[model samples]
Target: MKKLSVSILGTGFVGLCSAVCFAHRGIKVIASTHNEEKANLINQGIAPFYEVELEEILKEVVNRNDGNFKCLVGRKQAILDTDISMIIVGTPMGEDKRIDLTLMEKAAKEIGEVLRMKENYHLTVVRSTVIPGTTRNLVGDTIQKISGKELGKDFGLCMQPEFLAEGRSIKDTFYPDRIVIGEFDKKSGDILQELYESFYGDHLKKAPILRINLESAELVKYGNNCLLATKISYANEFANLAELVPGVDVVQVMKGVGLDYRICERFLGAGVGFGGSCFPKDINAIKAFAQSKGYDPRLLNAVLAINDDQAIHIVDLAENTLNNLSNKKIALLGLAFKPGTDDMRQAPSIRIINELKRRNASNIIGYDPKAKESAREVLGNKIQYANNIEELLKDADCAIITTEWDEFKILKPSKFIRLMKNPFVIDGRRIFSFEEFDKELTFRAIGRVALK
Candidate 1:
């Protein structure tokens, strides 16, 4: 059996992680970027972005001196060297709420350019999230124009959607729940599947795979994310209703609902809303795609609308609780969209902080274990940043636990009582124990109303 060599385009979460992890698994990975600086950083085993457990593996992979993985600026050379080339570039959303394939188009052009020079039938995998028909029509046609070769005979195409969470990407990559390979043909699927077989040898037994056609794979990514977003919005809607009645906890309601065997409790937690890289972007893209195809997706529209209001709902809880935000020292417990990663792309904290500023909150400060620096990019000097959880709560009038980071989860009620000028707590993630927190001070939370 010949060894598997893979080349990846782009150096985002998927591209970089896939390169390092595949190399860590002893597969040769030639990762390339248009940016010389980014390529340099990867070659030096430094990750330009923050992801948990990436640097360790990357460093190990680089230090092996095995040339298993190394980033290059020459993407064409990178493709020439590898048997399978995966396009993992960004497909950003435009102001029109549609998928912008500028990066993908560039990658496809590069792939076609490479194929024109190459002899062997290469496998081109689209790992980036794209709309249906993008692989065959946009990417394939472009490749054919440049290379002057037929699809199945000259080179193969596969749409392999990546399901990686920002924080837990390495673990997710190593222990994927499932594998999906959307193939242009059976040969494409077979080649990609064989590569996975080599990559995950024994672990491949644990992971199930879906070998489907191109559009299904693309839509599967959107469907998976949109449904999760809907679940979050659904829980938020229930949370809103729960807030109307005295002492009604939507946490309890969700627990009951989740017990119905069909709906297992996963993304059902009612929080400020869903954010970060994927959920918000995918929903908007797919919704826009559906609209362009002459079908209005009203449910997704509602999902986004509900998500937008959630941050405001949290701020509303704070304002109503304190009576006036004119002079309250607001402390935000978490700044990142979620725990572990320092990505604040569409974090709810941004919306929450903006709302706090609008209401004339005296002094707003925030603390997150990892996201402080990343938060600064979006938040700038809008809010003072606390070095630790204690400093965040110290002399604060009230604090809201926005993202459920593990650090905030351990803080006892006594800590809040001792640190704050007046201990008013809003558990945005329902992480605090109502039994314990209520016994100490005025406690409010999302999904449940405070008892009078």
Candidate 2:
């Protein structure tokens, strides 16, 4: 009998969100974090980061524990109490663009040590995104070396990749497009299915139970992310070319292309390029994995090169319009890669901001509906933060829109023109219609005809 005590290793966005989901569903949860400060915050039912409805969910779980849900701080209590553990630690990319397994190694070593002192059959499930064979090579090896116990006996392992978007994490969790389980064997697969069964209830019997080998499962995550990244890159490539072609509006072109049944459009918006944590990290991991296998990752290299170029290229256009950013106050309209969440992990805004710095842009006014705090953390005091859109663009020479927040789309271009010193708008994202702008304001968009 698998006791329903669940311990989550790593309480970042995915970890905490998963913990809340399980706990709310009457599953006892002990969420752990490496940092003491983070653990305490989570224990108090306060969300550590900016996520939509996370605080409300955490509060509900913590306040109404009723014996089913609980938040356990520190490593000792977490490992000691639970028989089923889910590792949700991050696997950051290294300087060489390889998957940095440092956090994963540490978590595995700790789990191995915990296993060494335990007698129960521990089910270790990895919910982190990793390369193929990472579990067998790194995690499995670490457990064997540290626990001094043979695999398939003392403990069972499986890979459960996360597929949550930053903003809609909770929604995606409860209603994931599909649930993927990568197990070492049928036994491990069955164990995971049982654990996640309650979430699906009667639908469990009908849900796709893709029981594949560990490596295939791992590759699935990277493959999914890379494909999405590829779509964005392809879109941007066309968007850039559209500018040279007369009478070509990339937006319309994409809309026409997307109408086809084959290419259902989602990441096809050709803006300032794709950003955020998953796409960039997973793409690099794939590239590294291919390089390790002695395969030339030329496509991956191009994908990254194009994204970087597009992001930096926006700044170049902005600089040209404004005649140098140095000592020129520039208002950057959007900060987060996408709207609906305050997560700025690997945002294209980083490249744009860095470029601004390089060109000695004296001041930058920035605003995002959700990602202000995260943007500040990444940008520091270099750029000024505006709590509102009007405040951000007010008194600025020119404004650049990096992120395509829905708010920006509805915002009147004349209002931005009214607020700025130069009244010039560089639409990194073609969020506004060219016809909407007046003749005086300079409006430029990527891969589209510039409206004078």
Candidate 3:
């Protein structure tokens, strides 16, 4: 059987991951991006952003797959050259908190223009997450209007949302828990199913495939993220209650709660709350979406509220410990939202740092294994950047562990004692144990009693 030729119409995290994953499965992948610099870097096998194993896989596909994968700057050429085009562009939040589908609409129009000149049948898939009816009503209508092509006759459309976390996107893409295909017609659905089967046949036996309507497919993506966000918020709520009760450990309590089969221990760990690209934006988008349809999303609104409060609580913990933060040299141990990637979108660290500045902290130093450069873009000269963990801790009055990176987890307690003027640590992710630190060191973690 001839392999399918695919074009990914964006070079963000999702588009890059999809391109590499498809190319690894022997499909020819053309990754399209409007940024020439990004395209040049990708062509050289370097990913623009940090994702685990993305660079290595991209190198394998670009250099060793006999030209199976290539990154280009224009969407029209890539669309014309491929049998399938997947729209993975950004859907940033608009002013009204709705998903701004400007990039998605542009990509669809470009694909539509390309399809007008071609005689061969092509499949257009929406891999970006949008509101429920977006795939059919917005993307499909735009493409059809621009190309003069009739849906289910001249071309086919499908909604297949990606369920990838930022840090582990490559693993998630190659081994998704489920594959969803929302088809406009049977022919389009069958073709997409076959393509997925060719790539994920072995995994399908373990992970089920869902064939549903376009709206359901779109809803599935938002539903999954919102539920996970809800779990994190729920745990944080418990953590807040646990603080009032001395000697109560939220971790052990949640562990017992998760032993129940109904609530497994996935996103149950309480920390500085959920922050990243997906949770904050998706929850807001969904809430706005519901309101637009004359519906109220109370639970989702509470989830956002809990998350916002959690970020503020971390700053409260720091201020209470130091007594006065006006001239304190504070050390922030992590910058990225979570470990393993350089993505700092809505990271708890950002809120924590901003609050520290507002409280007149004299010096705020930050360190991240991979996200320092990315953090610089968001934080700029507002805070000090550290070369290493030791440097971040040097002469610091207190330290806060925001991200639970492996490097931060393995640090010896003596390092804190030796470097900091006062070894006061506020652990957001609970990466350390109370008993591990020396008597001179002060340690506090969320959902547990502080140790002095």
Candidate 4:
């Protein structure tokens, strides 16, 4: 079970993170990526992107020089060295908001070329977020065509979806809730399951490993993500309703709703909307995929409508509060989609800024404790960047809490009152207390009707 080494293709969040975590566990890991610069950074013990609790473990794993982990650029040799190859490539959402399998197909071809020449039977696992039937239909066909290998006898294939949160990827990898393996056959599933059983020795006791057909495994990731997104959208819908009824807070409403034995309180936070790489993209793909198959997902459509409207609603809230955004210096508290990550893929802040720009608001400043560089990449000179919270709030006519950073939550009302020219605040994240902020400044929030 523990005899085999692993090769991960791609340097995306799941790829590099899984490679490093596996190596840290003393398993031999050879990862391949096209990005030479990112490879250099990874080999030097530096993570190219920011993720919580990644760097410290990564530095130790790299410095140990135990030959457990090494990232290379476009090498079939890496695949040759490892017994298992995990294609962790990106399945990006195209402009049409559908899951694009270009990268997935390319990765399969790369592995197929490697497997063609190899004498030893190797296992290939697709660990990327993909639509149903992708592993069995698209990936399996391409690999078999290139390698001239029999499906179950020549080599192995598995689709193991990773359920990793961006900020807590390391922790999730080490102690995941469950392991879902969609295998080509019993042989393939057994090999992949053995690896996990070996690596996560005692974790199997708590987290059951589910072995299923490839299509079911692929859809599980989408179902999990879509349901979570729906919960977020559902909470948001209630949060908005709470605003209409005075003396009602969604926080209290959800806390009670969460007390039920079935409904957990994980994604029920009333906020601007769900963003980042997973929720929006996954939900959209599954919805589009379902519609293409001639079954329209009414719930998902509603979820998307509610989420898309959230950003516009926030901008509308700001306009109503400030009477007009023209000639006003607006400050965005956080730029990243969420805290402990620099991921800003579909961040509501971008939508809000675009709406503000449409309304002719030119002076916009933003600050994020950890996402400044990535923010700059996405928002290149679109707005002034502040060195800190005080810097962003300083001389600003209105402040919008776009992200709920820990540092931003600790901020007192007096701080914004002292810093801003107008001291007008909009709580998009609902981090600050409505009672405190509404008492101190001309404050407006997404949820919770004003008590004054």
| TM-scores, each model vs. reference | 0.97, 0.95, 0.98, 0.98
lDDT (Cα, tens digit) per residue for candidate 1, span 151-210: 999999999999998899999999998999999999999999999988888887789889
Q: What C-alpha root-mean-square deviation, in Å, does candidate 1 show against the real structure?
A: 1.4
How far out, in Å, is residue 448 in model 4? 0.6
* Better structure of 1 and 4 per lDDT: 1
TM-score winner between candidates 2 and 3? 3
Residue 87 Cα positional deviation in candidate 2, in Å, after optimal superposition: 0.7
Where model 3 places Cα greater than 4 Å from the true spot, the runs are 438-440
Ranking by TM-score: 4, 3, 1, 2
Q: Residues 1-452, candidate 2: write the lDDT tens digits.
A: 54467899998889999999888888778888868788778767899887888899998888885765555655666877886788999898888878999999999999999888888778888889999888988998898889998778878889988889988888877777678898877777777888778666765565566778889889889888888888888888898799889668888888988888899877788888888888998898888789889998787788888898896778878877778677778888889888777878888888888888888987988999888888888889988899998898887888888888888889886797788877888888888887666355787778777643
lDDT of each: 0.91, 0.83, 0.89, 0.89
Over 260-328, each residue of candidate 3 has an lDDT whose tens digit, in order, gives 999998899999988888888899999999998899999999999998888788888888889899888
Of the pair 1 and 3, which is ahead by lDDT? 1
- Looking at model 2, the pairs that clash are 239-447, 326-360, 327-362
The TM-score between candidate 3 and the true structure equals 0.98
